[model samples]
Each structure stands twice: as C-alpha cells, then as structure tokens.
Target: MEKITNFSVRIVQKYLPSAFVLAVILTAIIFVLGITIADQGPMTMAGYWGDGFSKLFKFGMQMVLVLLTGYVLAMTPIIKNALNALAKQANTPKQALAITIVVSFICYYLNWGFGMVAGAILARAMGSSVKVHFPLLVAAAYGGELVRGPSSSIPLIIATPGHFMEDAIGIVPVSQTLYSSWNIALTIGLLVLLVAFFLLQKQPKDIIVLEEKEEIIETKVFEGKMCFSDWIEHSRIPTLFLGLLAASYIINKIISDTFSLNLNTMILIFLALGLLLHKNSASYLNAAELAVKAARGIIVQFPLYAGIAGMMTNAGLVTIFSNAIISVATIKTFPLLTFLCAGIVNFFIPSGGGQWAIQGPIMMEAAYNLGADPALTIMAFTWGDGWTNQIQPFWALPLLSVAGLSARDIMGYLVIWLGISGIAIAGTFIILM
Candidate 1:
C-alpha cells in the first residue's frame, strides 16, 4: 500500500507540471492573438484579463455553493453510516464500483452541485475500509461525472433551434433539422455507451495495480451522538439552502430570457445574497475568502478560453472548418456533422454557453441553408459539448483537486469511457440524420 500510495503521489507530481504548462501556453497564445490580431485593440487583452479578475468574486460564490453543498452532504451522519454498512456488505472493487455509479447517477440527476456533494459524502461515509481500494473509489466518482452530462448542455437539449433558424434565415426548413429526433438518438447512444463502459469495467485487470502493502485504517466512532440536536442544526440552514437553489433556478431562467437587463438583475441578486447570508463581519469576510477560492478556477481560465474563441471566430477559423465539413457532408449527414463539430470545438471552448455564443450562429446558418432541423442542430451541439468533457482537463480539475487526485491518475481510466461517449453521441447524430 505504501508503494502504491507513493506511485500515485509521483504520478500526481508529474502531471501537475504538464497541466500547468498547458494552461500557461494556452493563455499566452490567446492573449497574444487578442492583442496583435483579431482587431481587439491594444487594450483589449488587458480589458479581458481585468474583466475576468473583477468577476472573480461572483465565480467564487458559485464555487462556494458547490463546495458547501458537497461538504454538508458528506457531513451528514446518516449518509456516513449508510456507506459504512455498504462497505461491509460489499467488500470488493466490482461491488463498490456498481454502488458508486448508481449513487452518482441519482445525485447527478438531483443537481450536479449537490450530486458531487452526495458522492463525496457517501465515499467518506464508507470510511477507511473502502479507502483500502482507493482507485476504485475515485473511479466511482468519475463515473458519475461522465454519466451526469454537462450542466450547460441540458439547456441546448430543450431549446428550439427553429427560433435561431428564423433569425439566421428568412424561411424555415421543411423538415425538423435537429430537435427532438437528435435528442432521442443521443439518448439511445448514451445508453449504449454506458452499457459498454459497464462491460469494459468488469475486468479489473486493466486498472493500474499499485504494489500491495499493509492497510492503514482510520475509524471514527460515534458514541452517544446528539442525534436530534445534530439533525436540527444541520437542517436549520435549509431555508438558506433552498432559497439559494430557487435563486439559482431564477438566475438561469433570467439569463436565458434574451433580455440583457436580467443579466444585471441576476448579478445584483447574487451579490446581495452573498452579503445577507454572510451574517457578521467575520463571517462575511470568511464568505468573501471562500468565494475568492471558488472563483479562481473559472476566472483564471474563462478569459483565455474566451479570447481563443474570439480569435478563432473573428479569423473565420470556424467558417473555414465548417465549410470543409459542409463540402463533404450531405443533407442526410446534418446530425452527424453537428455532433462532430460540437465535439471538436468543445475541446478548445469547454463552456457550453461560451461555445454556443460562438458556434451557434454558424451552425444555425448551416441548418437553414441545408434544409435541416434547427432543433436537431442544437442537440448535436449539446452532445458534442458534453461528450468530450470526460477527456477535457478543464472540468476534471475541480473534481480531481477536491479528491486529492491528479488528472493523470484518472485520465487513463477515462479513456475508454470518453471513446464510448463520443461514439454514442456520434451514433445518435447519425441515427437522427
């Protein structure tokens, strides 16, 4: 076990440099382009970076909500106890993996933020007995992430591409270009992908085996625990939690409402709530600190990505790429093409909203010209944005960092699932087409 732990540590150390280097190079390239070309002006690069920095607090608030949800769920005694029971009931890697996937899926469907929390709580509740097989435990959480789909991707699934098509072109296409049909195909594809992943995962031999050593168990004994009081204290914050959840829903709705005024309202509400719930000065300070920590990942990363996207779009990179796609792609191939393009772009632009902002215009145009379903085009984009996340380093960072693991440790494990997801998405598109 000591050897295995050491090996995992080394792998983490090795990967950290690579991840950091990639981030720096990507950021630099984008900034250079924004300044030198793209006609963004001399101050544009600085403005982009500054704007990202300023929004750090808002980003941090989102992160705090994510962490708090996860932390609170983990802290629940019932969940902890349940995990202990499960660990004793099913002792092997296969059993644990199955349980993890089911739990993750349930949690994810509830809400990705909360789902992550629930997964962490369950994993911790299982205790040291389960941690004896750390790799399996980690894999379980990751499995959930893949199965959950992207948060932003969900919106595209329901949005009528027809609306965008009308704006892009004067006349609507005769056939539904890509709405419900594409969704159905993608759903079926994802189901098959999940099955394949399950089958492939049955063989534990493929997993990297660390040198076995003596197990070190850490057990927490709950003796004469104040069950009632604990429950009340924990549940006391539900008003705040529920209020936040509702606000989140409203914020999402307002952002999607097309009236830009709602964006300002949403921001104001977020700030006010942060201040209100913060209580005393010390607590408020703490909230502020937490918010900063939470926002770091998004704030640091988003601008560079946005700039890259801007450059690509301005330079006609997407037009050039999409044209190539159109040259060979037939009307019957619309669904597949949409999926492929969405997936490819997702690698560079990880955010669903961000990707849509850039790719949506071009895609809508294509759908109108080709006599395809606009809704189907949106679904294709959704599939592409989500399917690649399993392999994308950006989204994996938060989860991995929280789990005390690095990308390299899990990257190999995700390879099969990523391929499976891609095929499922692509296949769905083809079927719909």
Candidate 2:
C-alpha cells in the first residue's frame, strides 16, 4: 500500500495541471462529447455553454458566502482557541491523524460546508502544533467529507418544496434518505473504516512544515475625533445590533420552517454568527479579507463548473449519458448502475445540486420503470457524488486554498481513500438493495 501510494503521489505531482486548467480541460472535453455523442451543432453548443456559464450565478454566490463566512468564523478568537486546544490533544503524528479524521467527520456530519472549511483549518492548526504528514492530514480531513450530511445540497434540495422533481416524488422526507437506517449505518461504518485507515497507514518522512504568515491585525484606535462612519466601522455597537437582527431573522426562519439547515439558511446563520462572534466590525472584516483570499479559487472556478452543468443539461447530453446506464440496469442492479453513472457524470457536473438537476429526472424514470426504491436510488446517486469528490478539484478548491497546497499535493493521497470509500459505499448499496 505504501509503495503504491508513493507511486501514485509521484505520478499525480508530476502530471496534474492547476485546477483552473483542469476545469478548462473538462470544459473542452465536455464540448467535444456534446458534439459527438449528443450530436449538437457548434452554434447550439455555444448557446448551451453561454447559458450554462450564468446558470450557477445564484448557487455560486451561496457557495462563496459559505466559504467566506466559515473561514471568518474559524478565525475568531474563540474558534481558534478551541482548535488550538484540540491540536494539543495530539502528541504524535498518528494521534494527529486521528484527530483530523474525527474532527472533520463531526464537522461535516453537522454541515458539509462547515466540515470542509473547519477540517482544513483544523489540519493547519494540527500541522503547526505537531510533526505530521501534511498531505495525508489534509486528505484525511477531506476523506471525512464523503458521507452525505443532513445539510448537504442534493438531499436537502430534494426534500425542500418545489424542487424539480417535486411533482414526481412529492417531497421525500429526510427520514427516508438522509436519516434513514441505511444511510446512518453506512455513515457510521465509513467513519470507522476511515479512522482505522488513517491510524494504520505508514507514516512518511519528509513531511512539510507549514510556514507561519503574518495576519492583518485589527485596530481600534481612532486617529482623532470619531466620525459616524468610523464608529460604524470600528465600534461594536452597530455591528452587534445588525448581527442581532440577522440572528433574529434566522431564529424566526428555523421556528417557522422547522429545524432544517438548507443552503440559504446555513449561509445566513454563518454570516450572522460570524459577525456576532467578532469583537468589532474591523476585526470581522479583517477576518473576512483573509477568508476571501483563501476562497479565491472558489470565487473564480464555480462559474466554469456552472457553465459545464449548463452544457450538460441544455445540450441534452445528461439524458444520453444517464439513459446509456439505465439501459443495462435491472431492478436488482439499478442502484449500483445509477451510482456508477452518477459518479461518472459528477466529473463533468461537479456540483451536487447541479448533478441532481441534470440526472435526477433520468434516474427517477429508470427507478420507476425498474420498480426500485426511489429513496435507495437517490442514495446511490448521493454516494456517487460524494465518492468522486475526493479527486474532484471543484470541492477541493476551498480546502486546498486554506491549506495553501495545490490539488496535486493532496489528490494522490485522496485517490487511495477514494478506492476505500468506493468499496464501503458500494457494499452498503448492495446490502440495502
């Protein structure tokens, strides 16, 4: 395992392009596939691409806010102190690996974006405090994100009212999917297996030590007289009051809408809570600036993925691909086949909600025809989407940005976990089916 892992790491480090370039490459590949397989004309393909580019504008903003707010929240003194305290529990590299896996699992299991951001931050903190394999640590943190959390995009979107499939599926509740006995068991088993994998992997020498960088310090001193604008920027009162207002709105939403953490609500709560936790507006903005820097990749790359999704959907390629897979599926084999197809489609349309939009209808048609459980089929797609994310650079952008490493540095390690996670997830699908 160690030798193979080393070989894969060297191969990826030598060959993988920058994630942005990879996104471009994916765009080009999808275009060719659209023309050849879907028989799309050049003008039509251009239209699809153009339409696709802007399709994710709203979702892109939500994701960026998730990354930004999560980062700002992590930078607060309280969160930082808690992370540092967690770091102290790890006296050795192996223990540090365990800590990364557990903390990331708990965070992601609570909320996917929180887990992604918090896991990366926790890895950095652990790296600063202990001698550990940095790439493996980051990879392990990402590995914890493979299970679908309740707040995950696709399931939550499906559960919400007026989703694309609302008329077809009639709002399949979380109890039938996210909180299902099958999903709960599978998640627990995945966590346990991943923890064991990290503990048992041979430690590599030549681990990189994280470099310390100077942070923007927040200042409260006014030069002379405090102006109204200066007070708004530097004082706690106005910011705190606004934060309270935001919090009150979120509280009302929870009470009225039930205790669900959908994307919009999660972003709102995180933004408000981040503002509330900071000492003053300056401090919050300073942390926010850092967060923006870390999330630069996400800010730029999401539109490209969105465009890819647009092409996949508008070009009629999603149905072609999904139907090709559905053609071979029996009732007994439908779940696995759909899972495999979803994993393949995820490479092109990387966003969970986006993939569901394109593939959900096709998968539902096949499930209905084959007389399979719609819930199980949906979970299959869920696992596939989460499964390939280990190597997919899209979701890794924010985590990689936070750790200050390129995808090549961690993806090779993640490829190993991808195989492990695939088996566990696939096995569960078989059992449940």
Candidate 3:
C-alpha cells in the first residue's frame, strides 16, 4: 500500500500540468471528440464551444464568491482560533487524515459548496498542526463528498414535486433513495472504511510538513487624523448593520424555506460571518482581496471547462456515450452500467443538476423499460456523479483554490480512492438492486 501510494503521488507530482493547462488540453481533446463522435462540423463545433465558454461566466462568479467568502470567513480571528483548536485534536498524520475526512464528509453531505470550501480550509488548519501529507489531506477532504444523500443535487431534484420526469419517477421522497436503509448503511460503512484507508496509507516517512502562512491583519493607525473616507472604512457600525441584515435573510431562509442550506445560503452565511467577525469594512475588504487571489484559476479555467461541456453537450456526445453503455446492459447489469456511464459523463458535465438534466431521462427510461428499480437506478447515477469527481478538475476548483494546490498535486492520490469507492458503490447496487 505504501509503495503504491508513493508511486501514485510521485507520478502525479511529476506529470500533472497546472490546472489552467489541463483545462486547455481538455478543451482540445473535447473538440476532437466532437468532430469525430459527435459528427459536428469544425466551424460549428468552434461556434458552440465559443458560445459555451461564456455560458458559465455567471456561475463562475458565484463560485468565486463562494471561495472568497469562505476564505475571508476562515481568516477571521475567531474562526482561525476555532479551526486551530480543532487542529489540535489530531496529534499524528493518521489522526489528522481521519479527522479531516470525517469533518469534510459531514460538511459536504449537508451542502457540496459548503463541503468544498470547509474541507479545504479545515485541511489547511489540520496541516498546520500535524505533519500530514497535504495533497492526500486535500484528496481525502474531496473524497469525503462521495457520500450522496438528500443534500445532493440529483436526489433533491428528484425528491422535489415538479422535476422534469415527475410522471415517470414520481417524487421519490429520499426515503426510497437517499435516506434508504441501504444508502444509510453504505454511507456509514464507506465513512468507516475511508477513515481506515487513509490511516493505513499514512506513512511517517512520507509525511509532508506544510508551513501555514501568517495572516496580516490591517488596522487603522490613527483615529484623530481620520477623514470621512477613513472613518467610513474603519467604522464598525455599518458592517455590523449589514451583517445583521444578511443574518436576518439567512434566518428567514431557514425558517420559511425549511432548513434550506443551499449554495446561495452558504455564500450568504459566509458573507455575514465575515462581516461580523472583522472589525470594519476595510478589514473585511482587505481579507476578501487576499482571498480573491485564490480563485484566479476559477476565473481563467472555468470558461474553458464550460466550452468543453458545450462541445460534449451540444454535439450529442453525452447521449452517444449513454447509449453505448445501455447497449451492453442487461436487467442485472443496468444499474452498474448506468453508474459507469454517469461516471464517464461526469468528466464532460461536472455539474450534478446539469448532468441529471441530460442523463436522467435516458437512465430513467432504461430503468422502466428493463424493470429495474427507479430509485436504485438514480442512486447509481448519483454514485457515478461522485465517483469521477475525485479526478475531475471542475469540482476541485474551489477546494484547490483554497488549498493553493493544483489538481495534479492531489488527483493521483484521489484516483486510488475513486477506484476503491467506485467498487464499493457498484457492488452495493449489484447486490441490493
């Protein structure tokens, strides 16, 4: 295990390009696939890719805020102190890996956006206190998100009243899917196994000591010489008022929307927390400015991903891939095949909701035609969505941004877990379905 882990780590560290370059390579590959498999004309494919490149601009901005807000909130003195306190719980590399996975799992199970940011921040905190392998820690943090349930986009969408295939699937109340006995059992077992797996892989000789950088807090020097601009920047009253305002909305969302902790809500919470924690607007802005640097990859790389998604989606490549898998599937093998297909499609369509929108109908139709359980089929898709996320740079953007690392730095370590967990999920479906 140690030899394999070291070999994987070394290979990734040596061969993986920077995240931006990887995005470009993916774009070119997808373009070639579009022309060949998708039967798209060269000019037409470029047009689709061009249009698609700008499609995620808004989503990218939201993600930028997600990382920036989360970073700023983590930088707050109170939050930093709390994280440091948590870090002290892990004395050794193995303990740190275990704790990081458990914490990241819970956070992501609640909301993936929250999990993405929280896991990265927590890993960094844990790394500061223990001589843990930073790349593996980040990978474990990401790997923890594989436990899909009601919090996941596809499950929640299917559980909702008016999803696209409402007549076919008919509002699966998570009990039959996410909250099912098998799912719950698998989730718990997976968590235990992951903790043990990470522990065994932790070698004393391989521990990487990461230096936690000191945060520079800016403060107003003189109150006597304060002009209106300085006063506005230094005043706590305005920021406090805005924080209270944001808090009110968040509380309203929880009360009125019934425990709504979606990505938007998570962002708002981070924003409010940052405002409340910092002394004034200027301090908060300064922290935010520093955090923004972390999201540079998102700003540059997401459009390229969006473009690739466009080529795959617009040219019917996703459907071709799904059909290819379906062609080889029997009733017994349908769920497992669907899972494998979803895992493959995830490389193109990284967004859960988006993947479901495209592949859900096709999978559901096959499920009904073949007399397979609808709930089990969708769960297979859910597992597939998570299975490939380990190596998919798209999902890693925010976490990578926070960790100051690239996808290659951690993907080699994570790919091993992807195989391990994929087998677990696939086996569960084959036995239970």
Candidate 4:
C-alpha cells in the first residue's frame, strides 16, 4: 500500500512538467498551421503570433512590477511588526482562515496581480502563527480571487445574449433578473467552504518552531529602512498602474466612440503601462527583456489554441459539441448543461475573454433554439469559467511561483476548494434555473 501510494504521487509529480510541455508543443503546432494553411495569409499569421507574443511579454513585465512591490512591502519593518502583533492575537485557526479568505476576496476583485501580492503578504504575516502550509493559504487566496470574471461584470452585457432573449421572448432570463442574488449565494458558499476547511485541518506547529528558530539565530538587522514618504515613493507605482488602467479605458472609449472597436481595455492598459513605465533607454531595453520573459509561454501557447479554435470552428467540431448539449438540454436542465460545457472549455482556454470568443455565440444560438433564457446561459458560462480556477492552476501559476510553491504542491488543497465551489455554483444555477 505504501509503495503504491508513493508511486501514485511520483506519477502525478512527473505528469506536471509534461503537461506544460505538451501544451507548448501543441501551441507550436498551431502556429505552424496558422502560418502554412489558415486562410489568414502568412503575414496575418505572423501578425497574430507577434501580437500574442507582445501581449504575453507585457503581462509578464507587469507581473515583475507586482513581484517587486510585494518584495518591498514584505521587507518592511512596519509590516513585520504588524505581523508579530497579529500573531499574538490569533487564538484559533478559524480566525486566521477568515482573515485569509476576506483578504483574498478583496484583493482578487481589486486586480488579480495586486490580489496575488496581497495573498503572499497576508500569508507571510499570518504564517507566523497559523502554522498552516503556505501553499494552502495561497490556494485559498486563488480560490477567492477568481470568482469574479468578465461574465459577472458589465462586459457580460455584450458577451452574453441576454438582451436578445428579452427582446425576442419578452421574458428575462434568471441570470439577468437575479444575477446579484446568484453571485451573493455563490460567494457565501465559497466563504463557508473555506472556513470549514480551515477549521477541520490540522494546525501546523512548524510556524512556532520556525519563528523561534529565526529569533535565536538572527542578529538585529535593518536594511533599507525608510520613512512613510520614502516607502510611498517606492511603492507608489500602484498609482501609475491605476493611471495606466484608466488610460486604457479612455483609449478604448475613444476607439469605441470612433472606430467602434471593442477591445479589452483592462488588458490593453496593462500592456501599455508595462511598456511605458521604463522611460530610460536601459530601462526600455529591460522592459523588452521583461516582456519576452513574461510572455514567452503565453505567446507560444495562444496561437496553438487559436489554431485549435479555428480548426474547431472550421470542422464544425464546436457545432458537434454544442449539439451534444442541445440534445440533453431542457429549460430546467439547460443551465446546468451550460455550466458543465463552459467548465470543460475553460480547461483548454483559460482566459475568460478567449473562452467567450469561442463559446459565446454557440451558447447564444443554443439558448435561443432551446427557448432557454439567454441571461441564464450567460450566468452559467460565468459560473463555470470562474468556479474552476480553484482546480485549474494555470492562472494561479504566476501567483504560486511567486509564493515559492508549484501548482502540484498546492493542487490537492485547491482541488478540495474547487470541489466546494463547483458544488455551490452548480447548485445555485439549478435552483435559479
């Protein structure tokens, strides 16, 4: 039994790196096809690949800024002192877990990058006393942070076919009518699951051991001590980040107003700010390096998926997939089916926008044919997309790596959390549908 258990663990561990590699290879294949065969000319393929690569690099660099900010904040004596104070107050795992969940949710909604930094900071602070695994805390942070996506926000107005249903059928879909209510239900469900997990888990005594060990060996050392003003200047780029974020929004607004271009302003802003931040020649060069570093994986993989999406569309595989759902879907069960399909696609296409680009139209057409509420269909898509992040570690990779862990290290904990979220989301959709 012991041998078998160890073998299983080893197999799982071995599979992780292979999975990432396979994804990359598949992406390369797609790039080749897009270049060689797709109706889009060689130049178009090159442009698309280049654009994807550029986006990836920009995102990667922004990730670096986030990492730097987190490191600076974590090294602060004030933050350290506060953690020490908080450590004294945490009497139980429940308190620590509650704090973790709340902070995770808040930061995640504010922005995923900032949310990740917040999670690490909070984990380090609370890890002083809670004695829980750092990865587990980080996983919990990811669980909370991924709940809100494009489907839940105003973007859903354009992405989902809810409005069309109201016009055609003269009835509002459950998602359109009860979006907030469903969201609240899902949020509460996730919170309860997190609290329950923390309460039931064994507390780590290692935290106390680690702290004591550090205290004994450490000489009092202060490095880069700075006043509030200096600290503000150092970490002040969040303001710039925000400004870039706003500028992207304004640019999109201008584009929308003039050319009627509908682009993800948030992503555009993140890319632009990442490019503009380093004004100097050296820093500009560094930005290019950073972009390459950050975006290489994404750049490689996106074209492959884009190829897959193209193939799926061209060969009518998407129709077959949608038809499978349509065959079983009734008004009552349509929402559940929609959720399941969205969840499955999310495994391949992790980006909310990307998934929507592929699945949105098909779902809309199905909803219309089935006499189901389009809004409900959209809600189902959102629920599936957001709920699976607890298990789908792709998005959480950057966050986990930053926290000195890997997806495999935290997969078990996140799976448990994802199970909870999945159940909650599925149940809520059922009830509302």
Q: Best candidate, TM-score-wise?
A: 2
Off by over 4 Å in 3: 149-151, 159-176, 202-207, 223-225, 253-261
Question: What is the per-residue lDDT of model 4 for residues 1-433, given as tens digits with 9 covering 90 to 100?
Answer: 2343234434545666533665565455555655554445555555555544434343334444443333333333454455456556665656766777776676565455546655655665666676665655665666676566322332343533443433543443334533457666676666777667655655444432112222111222337786765454445354456546666667777878642211334344444554344322233333344334433444455554554555444434456676788788888898899888888767655655556656777787778887887666776887777667565655665555445556665565565566666787788878887
Candidate 3 colliding pairs: none
Superposed by TM-score, candidate 2 places the C-alpha of residue 323 at a distance from the truth, in angstroms, of 0.5
Which of the two, 1 or 3, has more lDDT? Answer: 3
Candidate number achieving the greatest lDDT relative to the actual structure: 2
**Model 2 lDDT tens row, 3-51:** 7788888899999999899999999988888899888987888789888
Clashing pairs in 2: 52-307
Model 4 per-residue lDDT at 425: 76
* CA lDDT scores, all candidates in order: 0.54, 0.83, 0.79, 0.56
Judging by lDDT, tell me the better candidate of 2 and 4: 2
C-alpha RMSD for every candidate: 8.5, 1.8, 3.0, 8.6
Supply the TM-score for candidate 4: 0.64
TM-score, per-candidate, Cα-based: 0.65, 0.95, 0.87, 0.64
lDDT (C-alpha) at residue 104 in model 2:
88
**Candidate 3: residue 240 Cα off by (Å):** 3.3
Off by over 4 Å in 1: 1-18, 28-89, 124-127, 131-133, 146-295
